[model samples]
Target: MATGWAGDGAVQDQIDATVKDGIQRARSRLPSGPGLSHCEECEAAIPEARRRAIPGVRVCVACQEARDRDAAFCGYNRRGSKDSQLR
Candidate 1:
């Protein structure tokens, strides 16, 4: 099937690109190595229980929640379509 566009599988191509981008972003944020004794962001000591539970933990619970809230508001450019760009 064709979308009447330049390519026969343009829709699939777009979907693949979106998925790849999301995967890349997720991989980049993952923590590396062993868990820290203290929170990287707030300098508070990370609990022993938390370190044991999450092996590669970086931030403590409070700091992680704040960081997540901040990340949620970041802008994304999903309007890859030409029609959306014109508006």
Candidate 2:
């Protein structure tokens, strides 16, 4: 049953974790409710089009971009496998 060097169930575990993470990520991106008129982060005006389009957008495009950029550089790795930690 073991295919990889990690042993039996390791690959399956990794696949399960990846699928769970994907589901969580997708859920997080789901729209919540009515959109806010302003950006919660920067207090910038949220355009009507964006609000209507997104349905629950809390941050303006610029603020959201900045947040995404910071998040990318924050080094918060969600996939912290034990094998990686041992290395």
Candidate 3:
């Protein structure tokens, strides 16, 4: 499908870009170090079971879910073409 001046592959390009963006976002959210038995964001004590269950966990489950929701809503902007830049 054509998109703007792009040819048949334009839609595929957009899909690829979107998938790449999602993968990047997921990778960015991954914890880098060992799990803490406390919430990194609020300092609330993380349950001992949680730490054991999810090694390398950084933030508490609640904090992590909230952050993920925020990220999901902050969708990508794909209209940064040269034409837009010139305006």
Candidate 4:
């Protein structure tokens, strides 16, 4: 049961929308076609095993790690407790 100004199923609708958006964002980031020998961002060697493991791998682990650190949170867990939100 929705309280306050929220209509019936409004919270669920918002949650569904958030999940859809996250899925789209993740799908968009995925690499396509053949994998590259070197990282696209830094031009570092991607290592033979990595290219084989991830079919369309684009960036090396170091560059990917940096990118990950830059965008650490995707805001997908906003419904958590205050402490979780802070983290």
Candidate 5:
């Protein structure tokens, strides 16, 4: 039973929605097709080993790391999360 303004199974609905959003976000970020020879963000040449390791890598390690760091801070925090409190 939901409390106050929330409908039935509201908490579970939020949880499911969160998981679905995460899946879609991850899929959207996946690289597809032929990757560029250099980092798209920094224009640094991609190493042969790195290219072989990650088939569709488009950015160099440093740029990719920076992107991941940025992505980490941009997601929403769930209710009651400590990160949400910090915001």
Candidate 6:
């Protein structure tokens, strides 16, 4: 049961939507096609183990770490209270 200004099931709906969006975002980050022997960005050789493990691996550990560090968190709140939205 949703509380406050949100109607019945509104909180659940938001939670479900958030989960779906998170899943889609995660899927988008997965590299498609065959694994590359070298990193696409730095051209460093991707380890044999990484290629075998990930299947579609493209970047080396160093480059992947860098990319991860630079990546923005996609978990931004989808629903804000009316008061918050007004500001």
The candidate, 2 or 5, that scores higher on lDDT is: 5
How close to the true structure is residue 38 of candidate 2, measured as C-alpha lDDT? 88
Q: What does candidate 1's lDDT look like per residue over 18-59, in tens digits? A: 888888987777776788999988899999998887779999
Candidate 4: tens digits of C-alpha lDDT, residues 1-87: 566677888768867877888898888887778999999899999999988877799999999889888986646455666354233
User: Once model 2 is optimally superposed onto the true structure by TM-score, how far is the C-alpha of residue 4 displaced, in angstroms?
Assistant: 9.3
Q: In model 1, which regions exceed 4 Å deviation?
A: 41-55, 72-79, 82-87
Query: What TM-scores do the predictions have?
Result: 0.58, 0.51, 0.52, 0.57, 0.51, 0.64
Model 5 spans > 4 angstroms off = 4-8, 41-55, 70-87
- Tens-place lDDT per residue, model 2, 1-87, is 444366677767777977887778867876788779988988889999999888788999998888778875322447676567345
What's the ranking of the predictions by lDDT, best on top? 6, 4, 5, 1, 2, 3
Q: How many residue pairs clash (N, CA or C atoms closer than 3 angstroms) in each of the candidate models, in the order given?
A: 0, 0, 0, 0, 0, 0
User: Cα deviation in Å at residue 7, candidate 1?
Assistant: 4.0
lDDT against the true structure, each candidate: 0.77, 0.77, 0.74, 0.80, 0.79, 0.82
On residues 1-87, what C-alpha lDDT tens digit does candidate 6 reach at each position?
A: 555687787767777887898899888878878999999998989989999888899899998888899988756675776466334
Span of 10 residues, lowest total lDDT, candidate 6: 78-87
For residue 22, model 6's alpha carbon misses the true position, in angstroms, by: 1.2
Model 3, residue 74: what's the lDDT? 62
Give candidates' CA RMSD values in order. Answer: 4.0, 4.7, 5.1, 6.0, 5.6, 3.7
Q: State model 2's lDDT.
A: 0.77
Top candidate when judged by lDDT against the true structure: 6
Scored by Cα lDDT, where does model 3 land? 0.74
Which residue pairs collide, candidate 2? Answer: none
| Superposed Cα RMSD, model 4 | 6.0
| Evaluation by lDDT, superior candidate among 3 and 6 | 6
